[model samples]
Target: MRALRAGTRTLDLNRRIAVMAIVNRTPDSFYDRGATYALDAAVAAGTAAFDAGADLVDVGGVKFAPGPPVPVEEECARVIPVVEALAPHGLVSVDTFHPEVAVAAMAAGAAVINDTTGLHDPRMADVVAAGNAALVIAHSLAAPRTQHPLPHYDDVVADVLAFLRDRVALATAHGVPEDRIIVDPGHDLNKNTRQTLELTRRLGEFQELDLPLLVALSNKDFIGETLDRERGDRLPGSLAAAAWCVAHGARLVRVHNVRETVDAMRMIEAIEGWREPVYELHNTRPEGND
Candidate 1:
C-alpha cells in the first residue's frame, strides 16, 4: 500500500499496521455512551489517546446509527476543535459524509476525510480533492445514518470487493488522487454477523484493490455475538480480529482502545519482523557467545 498523508502528517504504512483512535462527540453514540460528549472531554480523550500511541484520531461529531439529524454547523462545531487540538499530536481524520463538515474539518487541520458512505454523496470526492486531503471510502449498505434492515448479499466478500473497486475508480475519476484514497469494508453496517464474519475470514480479498484496507471491527456486534461477550469484555476478541486482519492483508485498524491496540499490534509487528524490536534482547545469540 502507498503512503497516506493527512494535512501536515503522513503515515508511511509500508509493511506496518496503523491504528486510528475513534473519538465520538455525539451524546448518543453506541459506544462510550457520551463519555466524551463535552468539548473538553472529547479533546482530552483524543489527546490522551494520541499520547497512548494512536497514529490518528478519527473525530466524528454524529452517531453512526440512526438518530436525530445533526446539522452541518452542529457537526462542525462538535469536531473542529478536537481536530485542531489534536493536529500537532498526530494525524486527525474526520468521519463524516457531509461535504460541508468534511471541508470545515480539513480547514481546521484534519488530514483525512473518512466518509463512511463510500462517497455515496457526489460532492464528497470533490471536497476531498479540492481540500487536497486524503479520503477513506468505506462500503456502506446505503446512505449512512439510515436503516437497511435484513440485508442480503449473494457473496459478501465478492460484493465488497466489487463495490470497493468501483468506488476507488470513481474517486480517482473525481480528481481525488489515487495515493490519497483508502478503502474500508464497513463491518456491521447493514450487515449481519454471518456476513461480517465471512468478510473477515476472506479479508485478504480486499487487497485486490491494491489500496490500503481499513477495518473498524472494534466491539462490533459480529465479534460480540460470535464470542458471546459484552462490549466491555470484547477487547481480547477485538485484538484477535485485528491481529488476524493484519496477518491477512488489512493495513489499518480503527478502535476505541488505543493503548491496548498499540501494544498488541507492536507485538504482532515484532513477531512478524515487519518492525524492529525495541531492545532486540530476546532469544538473541551474542557474537562469539556460543
Candidate 2:
C-alpha cells in the first residue's frame, strides 16, 4: 500500500498500521453518548487518545445513525475547537458530511476530513481540495442523516469496492489529489450483520483499489449481534475484527478504544514479522565466555 499524506502528517502504510481513535462531540452518538459533548470534555478525550498511542484522532460532531440534522454552524462549533486543541498534539480528522462544516474544520487545524456520507454532498470534495486536506470517503448507500433499512446488493464486497472506486474518481476529479484520499467500507452502516461479516471476510479485495483501506468496525452492531454481546462488552469481538482486517490488507483501523487497539496492532505487527521485539534475549547465542 502507498503512504497516505494528510496535510502535514504522513502515514507509511507499508510499514505501520494506523489506529484512528474516535472522539464524538455529539451528545446522542451511538457510543459515548454525551460523554464528550462538552468542549472541555471533547478536548480532554482527544488529548487522551493521542497520548494513548493513537496515530490519529477522528473527531465527529454529528452522529452517523439517523437523527435530526445538526446545523452546519452547530457542527462546526462542536468540533472545530476540539480539532484545534488536538491538531498540535497529533494528526486530527474532522468527521462531517456538510461541505461548510468541512471547510470550517480544515480552517480549524484538521488535517483530514472524514465524510461518512460516501461523498454524497457534491461540494464536499471541492471544499477539502481547496483546503489541501486529506479525504476519507466511506461507503454508505443512503443519504446523509437518513435511514436505509435492509439495504441489498447482489455482491456486498464487490458492490462496496465498486462504490469506493467511483467515489475516489469523483474526489480526484474535484481536485483532491489521489495520495490524499482514503477509502472505508463503512462496516455496519446500511448493512446487516451477515453483509458486514462478508465485507470483513473479503476486505482484502479492496486492496486492488491501491489506496489506504480504513475499517471502522469498533464496537459496531455487527460485533454485538454476532457475539450476542452488548455495546460495552464488544471489545474482544472488535479487536478480533480489527486483526482480521489488518491481516486482510486494511491499513487503518478506527476505534473507540485506543490503548487496546494499539496493543493489538503491535502484537499483530510482531506476529506478522512487520515488527520485532525490542531486545530478544530468550534465544540469544552464548558468548565465547559462556
Candidate 3:
C-alpha cells in the first residue's frame, strides 16, 4: 500500500488512482495552447477539473518544447497568481525547473514542484526540501526547451529506470524525503513515440522506485502517431494508454480531459478489484423477479 502526501492531500495509491489535471498557463503549450493562458480561464479550468474529479492540479507557465526563453520573473508572474488562487481548493503543483520559480510558487501556496527537466538544477531539490513540498522528478534526456533529435538509447526502459534511480538518490540527498517525492517517466519528453509506447507497455517496472509514479500522457504525439489521429481526436487512445498504465502500476496520471480520465480510472480500478461499485443493486434480478 503506497501513499502520496502532497501537502494536506494524501492519496492512497494502493486502492485508487490520482488524476493530476493540466492547467497550463503558457500560451504555447502543445495542448490547449492559449486557452487557459488568461488568469481567470486558468483558475476556472482548475476549479472545473477539481469539480469533475481531479485529485490535483498542475500549473505550468512555460511549454516543455523548445521556444523563446521565458525569464524567471515572467514564469513566476504567470503561475504565482494561479497557484495562490487554487491552493485552497486542493493540492496545486507548480511545474518548473528553475529553483527561484519553484521557491516562489511554494511561497505562494503550491504544495508540489513538478520539474519536467528531471531536477536539472539541483538547487530545485533543496527548495522543495526547505518548503517540505512534494517533488516530481521527471526523466528528460535533454535540457529544458532544447530539442533532442533522434535520441538513441541502448534500452529505453532500463535507461529511464537508471536515470530516475540516480535522480531519486540525488533528491533525497538534497534533504527531500523519499515519501515526499514522486517520479515521472516523462513519456514523449525526450524519447520518440516508439520509446514512449514501450514505457507504457512496461510501466510496471517503475514500481521498483517504491514511490508514486506519475505519467504525463495527455494527447501526446505518441498516442496520436500510433492511432493516426489528431490531437483533438486522441482521447480514446489516451484513455486506453492511461488504463494500461494504471493496470501496469502507474499511480498518477496527468491528463487534459479530467472527466474521461476519471471515469476510465474508476472503471479500471473496479476491474482490478481495487474499487467497488457505488450501487450494487443495478438490475441484478430478472424483470418482476425482485
Candidate 1 per-residue C-alpha lDDT over 1-290 given as tens digits, one digit per residue, 9 for 90 to 100: 77876676567777678899999998987878999999999999999988998888999998778766899999999999998888888889999999999989888889999988898896999889898688999988767678888999999989888888888888889899888988999988879999999999999888878888899999998989999998888999999999999888888899999999999988888888788877755557665333
Lowest summed lDDT window (length 10), candidate 3: 281-290
RMSD of each: 2.2, 2.2, 1.5
Total clashing pairs for each candidate: 1, 0, 0
Model 2: ten consecutive residues of lowest lDDT = 281-290
Candidate 1 lDDT for residue 31: 77
Please provide, for model 2 over 1-290, each residue's C-alpha lDDT reduced to its tens digit, 9 standing for 90 to 100.
Answer: 77888978777888799999999999898878789999999999889998899989999999999978788888888998898899899889999999998888888888999999889997999998888689999999988889998899999999998999999999999999988999999999899999999999998889899999899999999999999999999999999999999999998999999999999998888887889876766647676333
lDDT of 1: 0.88
Error of 2 at 254 (Å): 0.3
Q: Provide the lDDT at 129 for model 2.
A: 87
| Candidate 3 lDDT by residue in tens digits, 1-290 | 46777776677889889899999998888989799999999999999999999988999999999877899999999999999999999989999989999989988989889999998989988888988679999999788888889989899999999999999999999999888899999999889999998988889999888889998998999999999999899999999988888878888999999999999988888988888888776567676334
Model 2 regions lying over 4 Å from their true place: 281-290
Winner on lDDT (2 vs 3): 2
Superior by lDDT: candidate 1 or candidate 2: 2
